[model samples]
Target: MTDIQLNMDGEPGWEPFDAPALVGASLRFVSGDRTGNRFRMRYFRNASGELVARVWFGPETEGPPGHAHGGSIAAVLDEVLGLAAWAAGYPIVVGNLNIHFRHLLPLQTVVQVDSEVVAAAGRKISVRGRIVLGDRIFAEADCLCITLPEEQRRQLG
Candidate 1:
């Protein structure tokens, strides 16, 4: 196995005292040894400690002619919501995610996924997220997350 930093790799103090330590060891930026194009997620934890991710649609991810794929949109939304919830000290797996596509989102346009936790009921957490193209709302999503033990979640963090 190759060695990588558990922190931001030379960027000082990204892991604050208040934030739960992320155990991913390292985050992936590129697909290994792939020939054609592939999707890559850009992420950052916002001021509210929410994990936000964005991706520009690829040609293969077309749903209608040049429009972006609905399935891709849903997957991004789910990923964002799940990360946001986990960053809030509760590492969980996405159980169910419901997405509503309101418009034909275009390809090559950057789509932003913003997510936040709405509620928590025992082992289940309710998360809501929105996919936006600049000021326009492209889709809305809600998710139910099942709490995972820290030991289990930390392994893949």
Candidate 2:
């Protein structure tokens, strides 16, 4: 196993966050593999308190000759969008996810995921986000999150 230095620059005023501290080991699927060539992610909150991430799509995520698979992109979106609601103080689980692919993301490149909670009514929370490299968007997504029932939350922990 080798360490791959994350190739992301923190934006001014962005507050770095520890996702595991908020969501615990549940995030291991997407954010784990610290030394493997899979997905490497760093989380933060922008000045406006929106959830943001800098993710490196390692060579292991390749689907096409040199790009990431659609499923891989979706998986990251699911985790980030769901976590967005959690970071905003909603203990939730993703109920539905809708994604639109704009471009094939190149493997071994670092991109940004910008997400925000759009609405919350009762047990439902809506979040929208996108994967991008500068002005080029690789994918866009909307996630519907359902607040975990008290019993369900207890069971997960």
Candidate 3:
């Protein structure tokens, strides 16, 4: 389903769509499973209009015997960065993503994620995102999203 089809009703903000709902819907769109029980992601608007989302990794997302999986971290980065672009009013596909793994993130701990739009050129959008635990950063990513034309996005459906 497309973004329009996944439109959630009666959102809290109720103006330009709730950021958390939008992210949750997009996660459901990509992952195909909405636990809706635990491991919630909260959203809020920054001064620059970027929608930030945070997820606390726990029993729900585990790998490597004890900590979060590498893929899971990337997924969160990509999702948040893409949502950053989409929230900026430019829907796009993943182009390139580079992440730096700094620390071993513990499971069942709160990990903060923040994404912001840096620049847009034609069909490309550059964004930056980071996953942080308290004052320490676990991973950081810089992504390039390929903006799709209306026709291309339509074809994906």
TM-score of each: 0.72, 0.94, 0.76
Off by over 4 Å in 1: 1-36, 149-157
What's the lDDT for residue 74 in model 2?
Answer: 97
How far in Å is the alpha carbon of 74 misplaced in model 3? 0.7
Candidate 3 structure quality by residue, lDDT tens digits, 41-80:
5555665566666566656567777788887788878877
Q: Of the candidates numbered 1 and 2, which has the greater TM-score value? A: 2
Model 2, 1-157: lDDT tens digits are 2233535656899999889999889888989765578998889999999989989998889999899999999999999999999999999989999999999999988899999899999999999999999899999999999999999888877
Model 3 misses residue 6 by how many Å? 27
Worst 10-residue stretch by lDDT in candidate 1? 2-11
Error of 2 at 114 (Å): 0.3
Superposed on all Cα atoms, the candidates' RMSDs to the truth, in angstroms, are 7.4, 2.2, 7.2
**Better candidate by lDDT, 1 or 3:** 3
lDDT of 1 by residue, 82-155 (tens): 76777776778889999988888887565667788999989899999998866899999999999987687666
* Model 3 worst lDDT window (10 residues): 2-11
Q: Quickly count the clashes in candidate 2.
A: 0
